[model samples]
Target: MSTTSDLGTHGERIAAAYLTDRGLRVLDRNWRCREGELDIVAREGDALVFCEVKTRRAVGFGHPAEAVGHAKQRRLRTLAQRWLAAHDEHAPDLRFDVVAVLVRAGRPALVTHLRAAFS
Candidate 1:
């Protein structure tokens, strides 16, 4: 991708497809609020899943998943609550997931799905 946003958008698309292929029905994408944006929202059976997608052209700094530290996780949790409130959606269980995409030149992007990444 030419820009970071483009790469991120591409990664989100791949992550959504990956989740669908794994049987999670996608509910929302790029859900935004005054707080922040949620990369993906999905469901698997009776559980509601909130996914954070991180994309990087290289891992010189660290893995993409590493980008979602405690602060980000906290924000995501708040966003999830807001999402539920806005949609009036209920689930017996809630989960947080992280989809890390590593793009390499001339090679397929590597995907790592960390389920229940944080509380």
Candidate 2:
């Protein structure tokens, strides 16, 4: 709740619930490896979704989803490959998604989900 990591964790929880409510079955949260971490892994029909959650108290700098640039997208892709190798799950499609959470002091957090955010 105090640190940025804590805020991120909070956002990820919100994102997971939101996705579930929308019918995506969450398979993993904070999945990690030597390469890096994936914020969420989900199944939506025949696709496997690898999601990144970004949270911020405000948007003075930029929107949270903007944080996932080209380099970060590449890393996520590599991490997705590693995750697939480590798990037994399979899907006919693969997707990358971004969940942006904006938390305010006196209001409920606002969540924006971007599906197929990258290749």
Candidate 3:
């Protein structure tokens, strides 16, 4: 895989691990539908979480979370709906979250989780 794709995959894995450690049970990763993609799907308490993970080698130009724009948020929401339908999951509370990862040479992983990132 290309460096960028590798970084993204790594970010997702790390995000998955981080959330699992926080006692969230993951329902799926890379959940998809015609509407779009959800990088991570997990359950926190009784609510369902749809997570978008943004990973960058370095954020010299912009922050990693900046990668997800309004349009992307809307698409994620649509995809979440499709995913819930396909899995026959109950219509519980839904939330959009973002996990931003910044990787720098010889540095520790910089991960940030923003809950309620989008409506």
Candidate 4:
């Protein structure tokens, strides 16, 4: 069985590729600060996106995206602010996204991306 960290890494890779395929330019992956970590930082047109990736082997618990709830949204917002403060560049638009990965053995993984998932 794959470890949790392995699953997460796989999901992030899938998410990054998925985003790039959809025209989002990946700027950073796994960006960390004293606040927390942003799974994927990307640019889509004029927007800067902070993505959160959630991976699951099965839907026994719930949809992977459901893990990013209200509290998590708040935290992500805080992290985005911290990221902006540390960076010298500016983005006219800012958004949050969630990438859900469903992993099954011997089958191609399923990926779902929720754009502008939260404020």
Candidate 5:
């Protein structure tokens, strides 16, 4: 894979581990539809979390989380609805999160998890 795609995949794996360590159970990764893709789907207690992961080697443009702006947030919301429609057994308790990962020299320098990132 290309460097950018590799970094994104690495970041998602790391993010999954980090969340699972904190008691969240991973339900899916890279879930895609015609609308878009969801980086991670997990359950934290009673809530279903739809996560967007942004990975970067440097922040020359902006922080990784900043990449998930309004447009992306809107898309995530719509995608979440699509996901829910496909899985009717899930509870309505839902949350949107953003995980920002910064890599340096092929190692993760920082990973930030922001829960309830948007409505």
Candidate 6:
């Protein structure tokens, strides 16, 4: 079994590839702020998307999307605001997305995309 960090890294890779295949240009990986971390920042047709990637070994800990509680959402929002402030330019349409990766034997077994995951 790979380490948790390794699983996270693999999940990010899978997510990036998935988004790229869908024509979303990835801008950044692991964008961080005082509030929290954003796994990926991407551009899709003039829209800025802040993506959260959750990786789990199985369903034992519950669904990955369910792990993102209200507090996490608030922090994500704060991080997104800081990201936009730092990358000040024309404000593109902003959105939040959640990509859950189910890993089994160190490989991605399933992937779920939740668009506009939070407010």
Q: Number of the top candidate by lDDT? A: 2
User: For each predicted model, how many residue pairs clash, with residues at least 3 apart or on different chains?
Assistant: 0, 0, 0, 0, 0, 0
Candidate 1 — what's its lDDT?
A: 0.96
Model 1: per-residue Cα lDDT over 46-91, one tens digit each: 9999999999999999999999999999999999999999997799
| Rank ordering of all candidates by lDDT, starting from the highest | 2, 1, 4, 5, 3, 6
| Candidate 4 runs further than 4 Å off | none
The list of candidate 6 runs beyond 4 A from truth reads 106-108
**What is the per-residue lDDT of model 2 for residues 21-106, given as tens digits with 9 covering 90 to 100?**
99999999999999899999999999999999999999999999999999999999999999999999999999999999999898
What is the Å distance of residue 66 in model 6 from its true position? 1.1
Measured with C-alpha atoms, the lDDT of residue 27 in candidate 1 is 96
Each model's RMSD to truth, in Å? 0.7, 0.5, 1.4, 1.0, 1.5, 1.7
Model 2 bad stretches (over 4 Å): none
Q: Output the worst ten-in-a-row residue range by lDDT, candidate 2.
A: 1-10
TM-score of 4: 0.96
Q: Any residue pairs clashing in model 6, and if so which?
A: none
Task: Evaluate all candidate structures by whole-model CA lDDT and list the values in order.
Answer: 0.96, 0.97, 0.87, 0.92, 0.89, 0.86
lDDT of 3 by residue, 2-118 (tens): 777788899899899988999989999997666667899999987899999998887787999998899898888788878887896664688999999887778878889999998
Tens digits of per-residue lDDT, candidate 6, 38-118, equal 899999887898899998878987987788889888888899888888785344588899999887775546889899998
TM-score of each: 0.97, 0.98, 0.92, 0.96, 0.92, 0.90
What shift in Å separates residue 9 of candidate 2 from its native position after superposition?
Answer: 0.6
